[model samples]
Target chain A: MNQTKFSSWIFDSFKVSPEGLGLYRIFCGLFLLFFLLPSAGIYPFISSLPHTFFQPPPGPMALFDGFPSHSVLLLLHTMLILSICSMTLGWNTKKSSILTGVLLLAIKGFVYSVGKINHDFLIIIVPVLMAFSGWGEVYSVDAFLKRNMQKVEGWVLTLLALFIGFMFFTAGFSKLIGGWLNVESQAALGHVFKQYYVVERQDFLAGFVVNINSPFFWECVDYLTVIFEVGFLLAIFHPRSTRIFLCFALLFHFSLMMVLNISFLPNFLAYAAFLNWTWVDHFIKQKAANTEVKSVKHKWLAPVVIALALVGGWAIIHLIGNDAVLQADWGLAGFIVISGSLPIAIYHLFDQLKRWILERLK
Target chain B: MKKNTVKKIFIFFLIFLPLQYAAVGIIGLEKSEPWPAFILPAFQNVDATPEDVLVKEPVLSIVDSTGVIADAVPSGKLFMGIHESQIQGFFRAHFRDSTRWKGKNAEARSWLANRVNQLYPTADPQSVNVRWINRYYDLSSARRRIDSTRVINEFSISLRDESN
Candidate 1:
């Protein structure tokens, strides 16, 4: 695409109103509150809570047991629960989001070092991003009090998109490290399948996965995950592409939920926060009367926006490279990447295929 | 000011109040119990032989602030049993202020030593070895010495049969 066209698209995508931004904040706050309910007392009541619910995983315990007490663990859980609750209620949501993100990161980091990291750990990154996005605008008590409210524009939205995209891209790039490409190391693919199927006891989905057990499948899964993750950077710049990618992500999560019983619901909810609040703002319009869109023509703004996006994208990929750590289970990571990225890829592919068929018929 | 924000905040506080209350309630209920107690059966009967008879005199030890070890009367019996609750009570009362041995493991051994002394006042105290096998945590961090909320500690008491 030409720079002019790219800039215009970027400008249009970021032109979300304060009300729309507020809705996004509210949605994110509510999402965190709801997701955290499981880890609260409600989790023990749930039969499906993972076995590691009551205590830290053995690996984490071995590493963190040296701490003065389990007070830190208890404190982290307590702070997270409080932050989510406060954010949901829109009571000091900004403060809550920041605290929630920090506490969540600390706990997740400590836990990850201990040997078991849940897919939900990535959800913490969303709140960290949202905290800066001025998400406390509408559904929050601050919005009610008419205090510290500010209008958010295209730049904020673009930044959010970039942040989300970077998360995927970094995860993908990390997998490519340590010569995951070599034929000999490609045997690790079989190990991946065995680890997921036998060790993890996820045999229910083993049939679908095992069928694609060839070296070709392994290499494809490896490279595809990296490409799709990094490809998300491109999608974020293209709003239309993002809509397609979002659908793909949903489908990916759905498949993981169905096949492996592992769904990154938090990350999905976080992505939802970055959406242009046109629909929700419209729905909530009757409750308050400021839902009209004001269109403004700024032809020069487009190119600037596009330039910013490109710079942002490069910065994101560079940052990802600096911190990228190769994971032991790149195959599993590949599977996750496929689950997240394939939805967009498949949708786009289907659209292209349909267009080709129509053209042939014509 | 948006009316929706007011409504949302009110609803949030409504939920928060009840959860905070419930958490406090649970923690309060847990604190009411002075200590947790458990009972394990001894390998043999205490009344089988006169040589295995346990003298009722309890030996008092002031050196260890936790409890006094009672000497046991040498009986030819294979095993002896004591009430877990009674042992736990002695440790809780004696070591209520000691800092060094405050956890579940410490409490369990202290209780067992006292119980052993209570059972046999005349027997060699060294013959009775109190080994703590399993540990349980209450609200306290039983594993850590600092700011631990551990409640009940358990221990196993074995009498080495010198006659054997």
Candidate 2:
């Protein structure tokens, strides 16, 4: 293709359904909520550590000079949890998503301030991009509320894919620079496994595989890693190529998790952004074709009721001051009931209001 | 936004991607400026002969003044059922900087002491020690026989303030 045609093709390719971004947003938010949020419970212990222990990285992260106090940590955690919920449900998504990203970065900064920085940057960047884009326009509470067909520019998804691709390319380039391809130097794949063995974290299977000590096998793995990572950028424009890389990436991550016990769940979920979802979008449209009417009327009632019920229950318990209720585990029950249903209720209510508004406007 | 404008922005960002890697890989700008999110592209696969393998792992022990070891178990395993990488990360940081080792060791000693006190509060405070029983293979031999294990780098920490 000529330059003009190529440029136009690239621009045209960037157009994607907002539903795709919504899917990415919801999955990422859920991953954060389920997998990452619980880890914040350690904030109390982390907060107790002396300030000198935190060797904060330079730039924006440097703001975290010392760990936050327990109360501040708790507050940040609360905000993060709330933000995650809103972003997931697509309630006030633009603001909520931005909040989620900022809070995520803040939390990560505090978490990694001690010494090493974890490679979970994608989880933060993607959401921030979504916040600015039209991600909330479909497959979300925002979409349900707006009651309008919204088409997001494809650039948003393209940028996210490119970010991941760039990351892999850099990773491969970095390995090349570090001489990972040179097997004779003993500083390649074989050496990596040996080091892991020395560190004594090797799983039975990993240990067995590394024990073979076959130079040929080691060389293949070493070269494969570099080639796959460096070549990942090619998958960005080609859907078929993306599937292959996606499978390879998933396998690589799973193997890493199995052998090394390193969990990058957020990054794993972020990979879903690369999917075109043309079929999934069609299926969603078909499914929603029927319910588009009733969904409008009932959106506001459920959330209002759920919120009041939770508050009233809490108030009644406080007024009663019954130790029996406490002993009966009512607190835990209330927590489970509220935390479990609040997101769904909020989403329902937001959608209902959107449809109601749209009806009135029509 | 105009289509042309969006295209221009896309192209600019596309260019920005490689320029970033170049900054990190070639210009060392990322290292000097140290953008918090920008990871310097460096891969490490350290090679070592079988002789470098530690068959017998080291232990960091807390022994009381009366010579009784503290009740604290040496669990270098990962926390919350995650893989060993997390625990390895804790140790890797200590090993990464020789200059900071002493300070880091002291911090670890204090943390361990506090943990032991919580476990066995009645036990009197004591000195902490890191002992390594090292054994490596004699790979040069056809059989690759394991060498006799010997104690190596058995360092002891005596806290000036036992309370710390």
Candidate 3:
């Protein structure tokens, strides 16, 4: 636990190739411009509402008397789109990334002002943290602008994992303290019933999950959720265990999508950092060939491409004609695709975790 | 960046672990902390217990911007699937704030009028009205039976508010 040991541990745990980092950068940009940002329409949608509903929860947003004017909100939304584009292209890495985070924070702050806060912390902060991760060292405008690039530091990825783990750990602990363990009451069932009967979010597998009214099953769900969430933080200290926890996280989020209709798939952006993407780069080698040449060619064209995609995404959202774009949560479909037959994946994850525990015990 | 600087940053990041605990548990600011707090509250409480015959639900009546009055839409429908999850907070705060004028909460009316305006933008004039719907579920397990629901408490606020 000495200084050098701690520093080495931090660096070694998160190390990835420059190409890997570059690919991840592109993945983030594409994910935002396509998957997450189109939903940015919701910000203007909410801001355009009456100011009487602008009562923010206790935060910096509470300082504002009312919602900003449509013009101000439109400006923030515009800046947000541009910032995401800048961060994606790795132009002015640190500044653009920070600006992206700040803009998302400000806008989401306005949204959370409407009497709720969901788990958007990771996605909002990833751009800012990755800026410092030296992700810009390769395949970036910053890198292209420089003759020589310093070694990319891997600490930021580890730091991000720490954050993810830390938040999960707190949530898990809070659940345990908040009576999730009570034998008489089925806490998970309570939530299932609420999301089912009360909220009427009964699309997909929600009806199926609700019918299994076994108190035993609900209790097991309660216990396992706490273990998985809390174990995330503890597992981060062990590289192999961290991978196992991340694997469980995939299943966990998919379960949420199915049972409760909550989508945390956006978390993949942060989790992508913990992966060693050298193999992915190798597998996509045919596509990776002369990426630098293509990137240079696309440098001037990237923003234009992004702008088109943004316009197209908004067009589709408006076409849907309601806020159904927000409700449909197309991102959750990624979970279904990744974890095909979610029940089987859950069983597999549990089996693997049990075997892993038994191996360590032996 | 220098290795020393990286190490210092790492230490600072590590320190965040304790700082967060202090902010949430010790300082007890979990509910108030800026931006991201560990607000993943346990879904401990049931929405409505099977035994509890009556469940309270909010119903909204609104005059659209085009001056069409539609009565008794589920309150959650007002937002039209945008963050339907957070309605618990909205319902609790503006509706059931514990008898400071339980059904007659003015903020609740203003909130509804605003949404009506947003939903039917450019309509001549809109009004907001809301009442409670208490209903019961009719199903039983081996031994447990849930009561029927009937909550039609009248707390009608007619707020004519313009969008700012």
Candidate 4:
């Protein structure tokens, strides 16, 4: 594919609707404000645990007694809240998005070193992409003031799609390391399940599993977890693949919720919103338009698109494997890779499904 | 220049405001010498004592080595019921009816009082009055200097045996 055609394809894939941008800004702004209010002691709420499962060894109880009283922490949180609010309101939206992103990175760095870091840290990518995508063009204070704003192009949406996919891809690759691949690693599963049961006593599914007393059931769970996590990148690259994978991801999370009684599955579901719903719609529309056009000469574009998708998918998976933090948890790292790539997978899957359905109807 | 002016104003207020409040709070704290809440009660010196005394044929004449009458108990065939009621009330007022103390009869309170008197024979029982002291002063500072040469002035009167 020529540079012009490739560039155009990339640009066409990312364009987003005004409504999508508005939704993004609103949710991101609200999330920041919600966390900031509690952090500042303005509204005392049940504090979320800062410790990640992968945190380094136990330290002094006094050190982990509560949130830090440092002035810098307060300043950073205040800045983040203001920036996100401004971005949502569309007042100097681009600058606010950039500021929010930078402040988030700074705060994450400070908190991650002391507290346990979660996969939610990947949400930072949204603001970073929004800063460049000119997402403030719609549903912003700026758009209201200007009265006339150009619609966002496809490239912006594509960037968001890619970012989401990369997140899941990285997570999947991270889990492929160490004893995670072994079918006999029932001990690790037992440990995680026990922790889940203790934290959430209503594990009806887990109780059944425990009563059955079959080692084979545990082995099946162990292999299925690794496969679903590692297969995320493949499942997300095509529409049919993604539909299958989405079911798998959903089932994976649901089973964990039922058996392990973990609450993080809801958070994962929320992040899946970055998938390329627009691309799917575009593919469907384009395929319908192509049916009537005589002498359609864009057959070569299909191969190029496939190759680009593969390369992009492979690159995301590679990045996940290389990430030092994800690699630390050999058993769970594959899930991290799959999680990183989930956004991209969803977007591509939508695009392929849209195109296939449109062609069949024509 | 306008931006610089706004920045300067912000920096000035930010640096000065917290310091001003902090300085005032620290000064107030230092002036108060505020003690921890739990430690305040230890400084209160509340004396425990009672007024009445009973006289009878001395069963045990407890005295210090200098031969001063510190304490004494009367011998038998007395109104044991009335004597016990008074002694039990005295013990209850001082010790709050603790299970550790055996308030069996009049003999128990007398036994304990006699033992205390023997140890400090010169301590005039009449002189031992309950006095409320100022709480602000430390308990260690209120210790009395015992002058061994000085004699106690209070004396016990012997009541005639009514049964005889």
The weakest ten consecutive residues by lDDT in model 3 chain B span B46-55
Write the residue-wise lDDT of candidate 4 on A1-362 in tens digits.
Answer: 45555455455433466555554555455544532222343111102222221112122222343434456567777788888778767788777877876777655444433222234433465566566555566556787798435445445444343333444544444344435445444533443433332222233365555343444665565566656665665454343454556545655554554455432422332344454434543464467467876444353233234334434544565565532332112112334434445555556557767988999999
What is the lDDT for B35 in model 2? 43
lDDT: worst 10-residue window of model 1 chain A: A41-50
Q: List the residue pairs that clash in candidate 3.
A: B65-B123, B65-B124, B66-B123, B134-B150, B134-B151, B135-B149, B136-B148, B136-B149
TM-score of each: 0.47, 0.72, 0.78, 0.44
Residues B1-164 of candidate 2 have per-residue lDDT tens digits of 46677678668877887776565444333432244443423454444343333344455666787884643244442122212233434444443333444664456556655755765578775765655555554534544345566876566555445332
Off by over 4 Å in 3: A1-5, A38-40, A43-45, A48-51, A147-150, A286-362, B25-34, B38-56, B61-72, B80-82, B98-111, B114-146, B150-154, B160-164
Best-to-worst DockQ order: 3, 2, 1, 4
| Tens digit of per-residue lDDT, candidate 2, span A1-362 | 66776565555545566655665566567656654453554676567666656656555767656778978878888999999899877888888888988888887777666555566677788778767666777657877788433456666666666677778877787788777777564344434443344554443245555454555665677788789888988776654455456566766654544444333455654665655544445554555555657553442332333234544654565576622232111232322333343354445446656877999999
Please, what is the whole-model Cα lDDT of each candidate in the order they appear? 0.44, 0.58, 0.65, 0.41
- The better candidate by DockQ, 2 or 4, is 2
- For model 3, residues A1-362, the per-residue Cα lDDT tens digits are 87667877787886677767766776677666655663544655576555655657665787887778757878887898898877777788678878988888888787777666666678877888877766666667888898335466677777777887887787788788777777665667767666666667676698788777566787788889888887888888766677668777877877788777766556776766665555555555544455666554443243344345545654664565534433434533444334543554466568777998999999
Per-residue accuracy of model 4 over B67-162 as CA lDDT, tens digit each = 535332331112121121123222223323233123223333444344445444656432211111111111122231121222222222211111
- Chain A TM-score by candidate, in order: 0.62, 0.72, 0.81, 0.59
